[model samples]
Target chain A: MSGREAILGNIRKGLKRSGPLAGTALELCQTRLREHRPNLIPARAQLPHAGQVELFVQMAQEASATVARVTERAAVPAEVARYLADIGFAAEAIVAPDASIAGLDWSAAGVATEARHARNGDRATVAPAFAGIAETGTLMLLAGPQSPTTLNFLPDAHIVVLDAARIVGPYEDAWAMLRSERGEGWMPRVVNWITGPSRSADIEQKLQMGAHGPIRLHIVLIGD
Target chain B: MQITSPRFKQNAHEALGDAALQRALGNLKAGFPGKRAAAVARMPEFEQLRDAARDLKNHILEHLDFYLETFEANVKRRGGHVHWARDAEEARAIVLDICRKAGAKTVTKGKSMITEEIGLNDHLAANGIEPIETDLGEYIIQLRGEHPSHIIAPAIHVNLDQVSDAFHAHHGKYGKTERQTEPRALMNEAREILRDKFIAADVGITGANFCIAETGTTVIVTNEGNGDLTQTLPRVHVAVTSIEKVVPTLEDATLLHRLLSRSATGQEIEVYGTWSSGPRRPEDPDGPAEYHVVLLDNGRSNMLGNEFREMLRCIRCSACMNHCPVYGAIGGHAYGWVYPGPMGSVLTPAFIGVEQAGNLPNASTFCGRCESVCPVRIPLPKLMRHWRAREFEKHLTPQGFRFGLGVWAWLARRPKLYRLATQVATRVLKPLGGKTNRIGSLPLAGGWTAWRDLPAPQGRTFFEQWKDRQQAGGAK
Candidate 1:
């Protein structure tokens, strides 16, 4: 039998095993669809292109407010160097080597840039994802030539330079885009979808950000 | 050892009525739904994800037998044993045999609904093997010798004081005085206690959130990190999962994962999402020497090829439970089963005969909130109706209720007689309503009237008012 036919046959077997009751199941499915209507947020809001990224950055800032450190998105190597110098982390900040920042004159930019290697007690630098999700306000870091999952999670304050043009409408659209780009062979070992800093409400249901993951998140929405 | 649904009800009542339980339940009401809303609001694609997840689950359930065979074959190929259990008794027996063969003195477990269904812990303890619950909430319930109150947050009904007390009582024997008065302190105490058990455990048993057939991987999501230690540290790791937990491929698992965590606790993803392929791979360092996957039927296979096949699509995110007004009010323990809320109400009746669990189906208000919040989109309310139908067919309902329902149905079938009876009843009862137009007590609705006063009907029926309106059209 074909793959589709085999699948259909199995479903028949599963249904027989599970039992029958079509009328009841249909009614229940309809009821579920109705209830989630209000809770669902629409894809489009009345915000301008710049405002959307700014809104995401603002929300991330609010969610990660408890953390002591935060990074803003830097457009160029010079701006990145300036930010690091301002924070007094220029001497020690470890930079992740990705294609976006590869040709930028880092030596003239006046700060040390390190390759994407695991380092202790140094702030790791990496490129911001193409488009960040506004709904979860998540930073979608795909492991490729430019971005690594470790740079986003391991560092004290992750500095992500997000290009405003890459922001998509929804997560499914984003996944569909990724699937097209990545193709079918050997999927990335890690695709980190970071929503705010690592948080836990385990203790007395009090919202405590930064339990095990990153303590701080900084997003720089570069309007080119 | 067979504690029926009625027994669970009595136990839950005793637990839920306590002041501590009420306090814990209040925390749940404020925390879960609020966070879920915030998470969903931040992601515009969440609805699309939910739809995709639901479709994927429906597709898998349609071809579950094929997936099961593929999963079983893949598991065996990876040097993992696959056991198919036709019922709860068989499942329990299979697990017990594995434990007996290994001569497991002590077993450490992660949270699993199937184990609850099979009463594995109780069975093991009866046969003289100590099954230790390593999950913080599960450990609390285990110490108290009670079943999990909720699927996600097992001890959600338990307050901090109760947790402290359970720790004080159970921790002293482990050479530690329970100084923990706070939740974090209690968690720290548990972490330390369970750490030792994890290392010394001969067998580690956990429940799979999703079992991928393509890779023969059993996926488990937990925030506490206890499941990882339980599976990796032990010599033998046994995964007990229901048939519905199987998905066709890893990609499908990922799609479901995106929906599962969001619907479960409103997180983009859980803190830990681990996928165990089989017994420790040859190159792997520090993993289980022996891996076993027990695929349990327990009346689930019967659900397939039927109208209720959609029920198998459930990812067990507990979204339905969190949104359910009944569950919110009384908590999971009140449902009197491992799978609580709307899903449990439908499932319990199916697993243990509709006659045995007639009240479970009737417990709901048919508010449809549970169905709405469900990620895989199980039509729980309609399933409850099916159970009700079964109850009526089997004559399981109380004779008085059955007779009253029969009379009501007969009257409902004849509208003219129903209108006449209503008119006469309105006339008779209007005086008893008094000036306030409310009855202090209802005659037959004993439980309904016990809580609140019943509002009295209007003196004139709708039909009477309509007839008067028709006649008074200027006598035309």
Candidate 2:
């Protein structure tokens, strides 16, 4: 028999063995579905509008949060160099890379940026996502030719550059767009949708951001 | 590991006494449920989405076989292998054989409860294959030689100082030059140390959040992106998931996804929602060369026909645990199993013997909080009652407790006699009442009075008061 047939056979045997209450249990499952509905935040509201992004930047500035901006078409190498210089990230700090970041002058950038690598050092290079969700202020990165998964994590301060035009309304829209783009047969093994930095409330309920993930999230939204 | 029900009380006592554990548990108590509430409040349609998700799960469970078949076919069409394991032994054997065939020296794993259930790491280790847990929480627990304390937050019982010590002790042996106390420094140390393992590991293993039947995809949601790396970089990717994880279509999966993140960490979604269908095709530039999915039954199939089948609807968001007062006080490790909290209390007996887990069901205060907070509304307190009934049927209750309950039931059945006896007893005990108007001790009620005093009863019982009111009305 085919592998599918084997798996089904196993499932059938399991159901049969689970005994009499299985039917009632399943019915109860249906009842629960009818009863307790959990709330879900819509994806559209999660994204910040163009006006909201401006206000957000202003708010960040007012709050004394370090903010940086980079233009999309500018040479990535030079832009990365300027970003590092401004942030005072040493040239020798470890770097992370997203696969989408291509044709960059790594040596000229003067920072040791590893491609598709997760290292412990302070410096890293990553491909910025297209848009940041204003509601959660999340950076969504599709794992494809241009973006690598490593750069989003494995750094103290994460610097991401985004193409403002590529922003979408919600996570579902991104998924729908991804399905349309990739089609039925081929799906990327990993699509990382990141929000803010790594955080944990594991210590006395204190909101300690960046527990095991990036401590600082720097987004460079490139205007058209 | 042999985890006993008695160990729960012991472990809880030890945990309560430890300042570090108390600190860690305090963080979880304040953070997870609070975030979930805020996230829920933000969305007007959150309840609707949860209902849809729950309905979708129920529908899928009804035709689980059909969906599993579709999923398996899709996976094969995409060049992935699917293995069927009827029980834990079969599951472990299948994984070990795969490792042996691949000549794998090292395996990097994402957090998989199924793997824990089947003892995959132990199996691999016994066979001389090193299985490395890459999730920081899992890694910490592994280094400390302990099981996961909580389902989602594995190292919930561990504090930063303990983590620092674990890192200092372990990383030093692995060539780490520094002992760091700060959280950032420790995280960096782990990242640096694990990076090489990720790059060099021959196989990657992960647990599935949801398995879609329509597209034949297994989805994993994670915050750290470790699961993504584990699935992508390795030459071989193996997914170990329970059979109940299957959903009919991407739409159904999406419905569940809406509830999963909100219930889990109060986020709209986790940092990463990865879908891996199969191995890489010719056009793909990067991915695992081979993909395999092991669908494990391991006593879940039996649950399908049982009253406890609703347990299968668990999305593992841990909402019930987050809200349970008993779970909150004792924490996950005290439950002493792969699953913990209300879910574990119901599940452990089913997986192991009911006789061995008698204490688990009785552990609850029956506050009904678990049932209320459950995203799927499992009615956990009722399930515990069912277990208690079963325990009684099996004559598992102690002889003395049984006799006490029998005498109490007899007295409760005859109101007049019970009232007279109570009245006489109250008059005799009135002299013993202290200045606090409390009885400090009683012969048969030492258990109640040991930790607290019993309030002195009023002279008249409810029945006597009611009779007096009736006589006055008649006379008037």
Candidate 3:
């Protein structure tokens, strides 16, 4: 028999089932996947909207990402520039191809930006976060024509501009947002939930930052 | 990949004496456990989540056939291929076939214990395909011609000097000859060297943390972004994971994901939890052109029908080893297999044959720390005891051990004789501890007394002490 059939056979033998489930038994198993539900989300993730934003900021900072709040979308460039200046990075950066971020007048803030997928040599990047999870201070970025996956990892420093309105309290809430927008059956090719800068405690168990990904993660929360 | 578990006693003995290894193991003891405790303290519903995860896992295992078929169907729907292997040899053959079809001259790999289990890199290299490990720990160990000493932290046994030595010895070919002492500098040096390989690799291979049946997604939980680069940058992305890792949905994966980093490193969450479906969509600007999943059975399917079924619930978080006293003493290399520690103690016997790996289960002290820290609530100590029982039943234990147990069992069956023998032995051994009240050495017990002195009993045996107390009216 083929490996697939043999494996299935072994599994059925182990479970002591004669064969694959048929009729309602089969549907019962499939339904679990089709209509998946969250189980016991931490009570901490069930906070109010403003509380979620506060939690996200606090948790993100705890994960070692610098957070800054901008009062308006119009003030994003200035905030990004200010963060770059504080960190001693150049004002120029590679930006993801999102219209919301691209349309921003970065030049007016004296910050030079190139809108494209991040190249291997890019030192800094500005990407748009699809959602922010307050439960763990994670940013969920979907890979699309507008947002490239490379923008999340191919740089030394990652600067993401997230709308405070999209900040969520639970990881399930972030998934719910995707389903509500794209329907239950559809999914992006890649969904990256990044919490902080890349790190490794691999060598001697000594914690080290910037391992094969961004060294610095700076989040600019646009709007209070 | 090599089975040295038959010689685990010797391996552990040498490991204990290697001062450098002991120092590295000391760091391991200082790390992981505290972080896990802190992370558990921060989450009030941690136990609740663990309960839910354990049930979810048991449920998945019961319906394993249904989930695997569904996961395969979803991957096909997402324009990906799912390959099944009944054993490691078949798994390696299938991977080699994929590489050959891709015309791959070189491939980049993320940290995958399964790939290590199947010994895929050697097969690929033998076929003239260079395999590059992208994870910093994996890379360092790979350069030193060593397998991962620890699963999560692959180079946990390698100190800073060893890492510098490996980099200094190997990085010269890449035009880097300077020695880097700081961990950050070493990480950067690896990043710079691997970036070129990531972009140039013909295929990218990684292991899946969870293979979701709901959306045809393979989730990789990592702190480093190397896995993303490994899967995203190449033309073909191949994910090699075992059959038991398949879950029914994204929600199930998330629940387990929540417990993983916290238990492994005490982080609230690892930095990157990347979920990949198929290759990049037509409209997508970047990602691989093809995606494939290789489901390896090896011996796990056999384990499911047996008493060791609970081992399948493992998420490979390394918490078991983190708190495992035996693992802390000897480190991962001494386990002499792809897996080590409490979980490995159970699995190595089941997967590689008990006769060859029987010593592994015997290595544990049954402290139950591994089970306590286990997120899936696997009864690791109970399973190790089961292995010990199996070893005795199968007559795989050493002749000396069997003879000792046989004599003890004979006396144990006769309580009067047992009590008489113990009382006499206690009196005779008492004089040996006359001055120091500790036995310096004893006949046929040199192994126990060689390292340190064995404390002598201060007075009579437990039964005698209990009789005296009852005579004095102190017993309840």
lDDT of each: 0.69, 0.72, 0.92
Q: Lowest summed lDDT over 10 consecutive residues: which window, candidate 1 chain A?
A: A65-74
Q: Compose the digit string of candidate 2's lDDT tens values, residues B276-361.
A: 77887664556788999999877776677677777788888888888888888878877777788888899888887678787788
Write one digit per residue (lDDT tens) for candidate 3, span A1-224: 99999999998888888899788878888788878999889999999999999999999998899999988988989988898898898998888888988889999999999999888888889999999999999999999889999999998889999999999999999999999999987999999999989998888888888888899999999885
1 against 3, candidate with superior TM-score = 3
Per-residue C-alpha lDDT of model 1 across residues A25-98, encoded as one tens digit per residue: 54443343222122223454235656655556554555552212223233366666656666566444455566
Q: Give candidate 2's error at residue A206 in angstroms.
A: 5.8
Question: Residue A88 CA error for candidate 3 (Å)?
Answer: 2.9
State the DockQ, from 0 to 1, for candidate 1: 0.12
Which of the two, 2 or 3, has more TM-score?
3
Q: Chain A: TM-score in each candidate?
A: 0.66, 0.63, 0.97
Give residue B27's lDDT in candidate 2 (0 to 100): 79
Listed in order, the DockQ scores are 0.12, 0.26, 0.87
The candidate 3 chain B region of ten consecutive residues with least summed lDDT is: B467-476
Model 1 scores a C-alpha lDDT of 0.69
Candidate 2 lDDT by residue in tens digits, A1-224: 74335556555665663322347754664444333232354643454567546644543333223456666545555666676777677663333344335545568767565555444453555565745544344556655445545565656677676666655554455555555676734456455656655654433334455545566666666763
